[model samples]
Every structure is written in C-alpha cells, then in structure tokens.
Target: MYTELNSILNTTPDSFTQGEFILVSDRQSDASFLMHHFLSFYLRARCKVCFLGLVQSFSHYNAVGQRLGVSLVQAKEKGQLIFFEGLKESLSVLISQESNTKSQAIDFLRDPSVGLRSLYEFVRCTVSSSSGGGEKGADGAEEWGPPVLLVDDLSVLLSLGVTVGTVLDFSHYCRATVCSQLQGNMVMLTRCDGEEEADDGDDEGSERLHRGLTHQCSLTLHVQGLPTGYCRDIHGQVEVCWRRRQGDGQHTQKKLFQYKVHDKGASFFARGTSSAVL
Candidate 1:
C-alpha cells in the first residue's frame, strides 16, 4: 500500500474505515493505480476481498498485485480472495454446481434485459460467507477480517447492454449488503465522459452513473488528466472529496493533489511540488 495515499485517505493498517462506499472516477486519464492501491490496502488489512474485475484477466491483476508485494495467486490459494474475471464469465455461461457467483454473473450475456441480480448475488454470497457465526480458521479464529467488495470498473456492465438504472440498482444493493448489513467496505471505479466525449453525447450514461455514485459514496477520488497536459514526471491530478451527513445537511471537504505512478508505488504531491515543476 502507498503510505502517502493512506495518509491522505486517513486509512491505516491498524484501523480501517468500514461501512463506507468509496467511488473512484476517471475523466481523462488512467486511474487503475488507485484501484491497485485499494486492492493491496484492503488485503494488507486482512479483509476478505471479492474482486469483480470486468476489464482484465486474473493474470493481469496478479502481475500488478505481485509488484505491490501482495500475491493474488497466494491470496486466492488461501481462500482470501474470490476474483470474477469478466472475460471468462462472458465466454462461459453454463450453470455450475459449484460457486453460484460465477454461473449467475453472466446472465447479461444470455439476455441483456435479465438485469444484474445474479451478479449482485455473487457478491452478497462471497462477502457474507463468514461475517456471521459462520466459518472459522483451524485455530478457531475468524478466517478473515472485514469483508470488502472491489469492482475495478462498474461502467462495463452498462456497455454490455445493462441499463443505467439496473447498474445503479446493483450498486445500491451491493452497498447495502456490504456497508450496511455486514459493516464492511466497498470500492468501485467508473469512467466519466471527457469534454469531447460529452460534446459528442456518446457516454452520457456513464456520466450519469458517475454522478449518481458520487452522491451515494462517502468518499470520491476523481482522477483527471493534468490541465497543463502531459509531463514525464507527472501523470494526472486527483480531486479527493469526503462527504458526511450532519443532521439535515451534508458537509463536503475537497482537496486536489497531483500524482505520479512508479514501479514500487505512486506518490501524491501538492499542486506543483513534483519534479516536473522543479
């Protein structure tokens, strides 16, 4: 995990922010690093993670996980992580006697209008496995920490012919199950339409979804390409906003930081403190 990012996010290995929804939205740059950050952060926190990786394969994420010093292969082998690979799921739709999460997840491929209930069921089943007086370890302790559900990107469900309302509904149910019912955490990534894409009116649905999630999420990390354009030392900028309900009113605090990704981890800097500025 990134120490600088953890400080900015107020998340530490000893204590975690549970029962909260974190939304990661990307406008004009790659925000996959943020996804990696959380994946490792939660794993290091010992949370049982259900990863719905819609855009990449297991190996792809495993490679990145290795670089971050968290081995996805080992995690899965030890039954700590359950990964849903969209490519494999979409290709194989046969119902299995095994895990219902996979068999039900590709319902959209069979019928576009079937909705994402099956997919949501997968997540609910995975995270709720041992939260109650359920499973235990060999030493008679709880097998894992708090449950966590991480979706690399939620917009791909829309591109696959699911309605915006359906996707939002899925998110709502997942949020309720993870955050409210189980007292766990959820992290979801979505792409927003850029200026040109917005002008062309192509990805308005994604924009709506992003806005909808932003309102529901407790924290939003919106990543955008630098206004000054590309620089070798800087990748993009991130706007971090935290929201809380205070009686009848809501309070929001926002901050912007520039970040650069390196082989080990990423660094977040003040507005102009990166090497590019120096």
Candidate 2:
C-alpha cells in the first residue's frame, strides 16, 4: 500500500474499522487504479475480500496486483479472496443461446424482473462463509478480519437494464449483509457528471444511484480529471467527503488532493504541489 493514501484517510491496517460503506466515484478519468489500491490494501490487512469484477477479468487485475506486491492468485488459493467474474460469466451466457430458459446470477440479461438476487446471494455466501483454516489470533482462534465487498462499478447494473431502485436495493441488501449482519465493509465504484451541476446528457439513473449511495455511504471519494485536460505530473484529483451522524443530525467533512499514478502505486499530494501546475 500507498502510505500517502493511508495518511489522507487516516486509516491503516491496524486502525481501520468495520461496518463502513465507502463509495468511490469517478467523473471523466478512469479510477480502476483506486480499486487496485483498495484490493491490495485490504488483502494486506488480511480482510476477507469479495470482489465483484463486473468490468474486467481476473487476469487483468492479477497483473496490476503483482506490482502492488501482492499475488491475487495465491490469495485465491488461500481462500482470502473470493472473486465473482461477472464480465466473463455474463459474456458466456450471452453466447450460449440458453439464456431465457433459466435464472442465473445475471438474470438481468434474461429478464429484468429477475433482478440481482443471485448475485447478492453469491456475495453473501462467500463473505459469511465459516470454512476453517486461516490465520489465528493471540488466543489461537481462527480470525478472518471483517469481510469487505468491493464492486468495480455500479453503472454496469444500470446498463444491464436494472432500474435505479433495483441497483440501490442490490447495494442496500449487500450493505445489510456485509455491514450490518457481518460488521464488514462495502466499497463501490460509480460515476456522475463532472460539471458543477448535473448535465442533461448525464445518465439520470446513474446520478440517482450516485446520490443514493452518497447518502448511504460513510465516505465518498470523487476522482476527477484535471480541468486543463492532460497533465504530465498529475493524473487527476481526488475529493474526499466524509459523512457522520450524531443523534439526529448529519455532518460532513471534505478535502481535495492532486495525485499521480505510477506503475507500482499512486501518489497523492496536496493541491498546487504538482510540477505541472508550477
């Protein structure tokens, strides 16, 4: 992991808590690098991670992962990681010519009415698993750190013909299971309009989903491209928004940082610090 990120979030493997909902939002720039950061970050923390890779294959992630100093292949073998290759599975179902006949994990393609129940079930089962064998604690009791559910992007669900409510409910149920029941965490990646205001061309359903998640999530990280277009020194900027509830009131805290993505990892620096701006 990137200590720079850990400093900004004020979180470390030992200090991180459970029952959190982290929403990673991207406007124009690709934020898959953030996903890689979290995937490796959690793995290093020894948390049971269930990755719903809907946009890319496992091999793609494994390749980026090797540079982060973690072997996803080994993690899968050790049962520390559970992956749901939605991209590959959905493609196979599309080509098989046997879609409309049965209810599968991606029932959205076959019939929108089927919803994402099977997909949620897959996540619930994997994270709640009680299978033996893992690192033990001081008491010698098997310890699997709080489970984490990571979704690469939620817009795909909308693209798949799932309604806004359906996508929200899918995340809601996942939150209920991973955060409430299991005291784990949920990290979702989504997108929205980068303009100061919502754009007419923006996907309304997606915006609704983003709004819904922003309200539900404890933290919102908005990653956006630079205003001047391309920057040799800075890849993009990250806006961190934290939401907290006390008694009957809700409060929020926000921060912004410029960042550069390198091969091994990404670096986060305060605004106006990049050489490109100077």
Highest-scoring model, TM-score = 1
lDDT values for all models: 0.86, 0.84
What lDDT does candidate 2 reach at residue 246?
Answer: 52
* TM-score for predicted model 1 compared with the true structure: 0.91
For model 2, the superposed segments whose C-alpha errors exceed 4 Å read 97-103, 130-142, 193-196, 200-203, 245-250, 275-278
Instruction: Name the lDDT value of residue 30 in candidate 1.
Output: 86
Which tens-of-lDDT digit does each residue in 74-115 have in candidate 2? 989877898888877787677877666533677567688788
Show the colliding residue pairs in model 1.
none
- What are the clashing pairs of model 2? none
Runs of candidate 1 with Cα error greater than 4 angstroms are 94-102, 133-142, 196-204, 245-250
